[model samples]
Target: MSTAAVTDKRHSTLRAASLPRWTPWVIAAGSLVLGIGISMAAGLDSQVQWGLIAAVLFVLGTFGVAARVEGRRQAKDRVATSLVWVAFLLAVVPLVSLIWVTVVRGVKVLDVYFLTHSMGVVADTEPGGGIYHAIIGSLEQVGLATLIGAPIGVLTAIYLVEYGRGRLAKAVTFFVDVMTGIPSIVAGLFILSLMLIFEMQPFGFAGSLALAILMMPVVVRSTEEMLKLVPNELREASLALGVPKWRTILKVVLPTSVGGITTGIMLAVARIAGETAPVLLLVFGNPFINNNPFEGAQASLPLYIYQQFANSAGSGAAFDRAWAASLTLIAFVMILNLVARGIARWKAPKTGR
Candidate 1:
């Protein structure tokens, strides 16, 4: 054969064969059917089990089919992609289920009446109570915690990133690391110890203190990361203009990373907002509406949920209330996250003006 014919033959042999776009979908459908059949034959009841079996079959079938038709390299790539998708679904399934369950169960008692009133005279088993008291307590405690924690956390982060040096800085960093891993119960216990020493009672402010302990480490770590991301060139530029060091950090570095800082603070707030152990230990939940967080035992959302469940003694009313409170807590956290993103967007440093 001539060189032209040989070249054409080599090119044809080297060209990869492409599968139809719908091939994977067809394989998945077949795998699902087979998995269902197997599950039925083995008398398996759980949908989760069938899903897992289907996922496994789909992955294996894809690899085997791809290897035979396409090539080993293509098969491996397909397998990796399949695994990633499977992992994503596995992670999402539980989250979706939790949200679904919450919505279904919570809506049974989550009405305007439930939100506006409180458990003032009503018993847990009777079903005529609300979360107004818990809402007040949660807001006060979390707000107090944020007020006490955010500034301190931000300042500490600034110090660590900007001016920290030697043993003191290292010690601070080490302590912050240690605090970050400390359990919520431990933080509550720490505050409890202080309360015992001072002969203090459980109040909203005590929960605030425990929450502050938890919030500070998160805020410090997140803010430190945000501050680090601010380019040193901005600081140098400001300093070159004869600006003071602190002023440069305030005007240049901070402004540049303000969005991230706010996001971090909001995230820290969210992290502490849902904590039940600390609130239970420090606030010592009360059923009656107590607006003054500084004076008496307070009811927070998490604590309310716990109390409802515990005090219900297997009453449907209590379980329903717990679910509603849980839903409300989830909504509150979601709102914080949304607000954080909004602030980040609004305060994001302008470019290309």
Candidate 2:
């Protein structure tokens, strides 16, 4: 062959020899089997643990092998990128499955009676007892909690992000952080102790107080972050127009971050809404509906679930009620989130830019 013809033949060979883009991903997937073998040898108890270990090992082994075989850095990059997507899917599947299970199992017992009737007369296995009293108690307690906690949390957040400085702010921030990490049981105990000190007996309002304590720090931290995200220019603009500082904050800063603040408050509400320990400690569930939170025992959702689940009565009806109450609690949180979204959208200030 002539020199030009020989060069053309060499180029053709190089082009034909190039590996496909998908080769690294295929290699990574193959490595998953090898990883599973390794995990099996390790003798871990959980299948999920085995699968996760296998996937991770597969990616690493694939990366090294692909890099060596291809003799290039880019080969390893492609393998790593594909492995991330695989990992993401693996994580999402479990969460979706959990939600599906909760919904499917809980919806079976859902009815108007479930929403309106208390479990007072119904035995654990009794077919007909509804969760009306618990539902009402949950609403009342959480509503009161929201009323009490939101203002305290929002104001604390404002201080922390806006005017807070020096030693006092730091102390407040530290205490808030500590409060956030306090065990739910501890909060219940703290309230219990306080009530005892005051010679007060257990009541629904006391339970609401405990929930407020648990919720406040969460609200403060979330709202503080949201407030900080509000642009300084908005505040400066208001000040430039000769508006007073308090009014500027009230009108400009708060409106700008109202959506986020509302969202934080809703999230705080959700966090405390399901707490069983505090309610169990502070307010014993009653057989009948107690409208007066200050005076007597009240049925709340979590407490109801516990009571139903703990007691064995006529049939499996208690379990069904527990599931139904769970579903109701989940629905309430979902509704609160939706309402927060609506308020955020409606009240969010118009961005001039």
**Model number with the top lDDT:** 1
Model 2, position 19, has a per-residue lDDT of 48
Tens-place lDDT per residue, model 1, 1-353, is 11222234333443243567787888889999999999999999999999999999999999999888766766887789888988999999999999999899898989999898888998778877999999999999999999999999999999999999999999999999999999999999999999999999899999999999999999999999888888778899899999999999898898889998999999999999999999999899988999999999999999999999997775588889999999999999999999999988887664444
Per-prediction TM-score, please? 0.91, 0.81
| Pairs of residues clashing in candidate 2 | 116-132, 117-132, 125-314, 125-315
| Per-model CA lDDT versus the true structure | 0.91, 0.80
The TM-score leader among the candidates is 1
Scored by lDDT, model 1 comes in at 0.91
- Provide C-alpha RMSD values for all models, in order: 4.3, 6.4
In candidate 1, what residue range of length 10 has the lowest lDDT sum?
A: 1-10
Query: What total of clashing residue pairs does each candidate reach?
Result: 0, 4
Candidate 2 residue lDDT tens string, 130-175: 8888878888898899899999999999988889999999999999
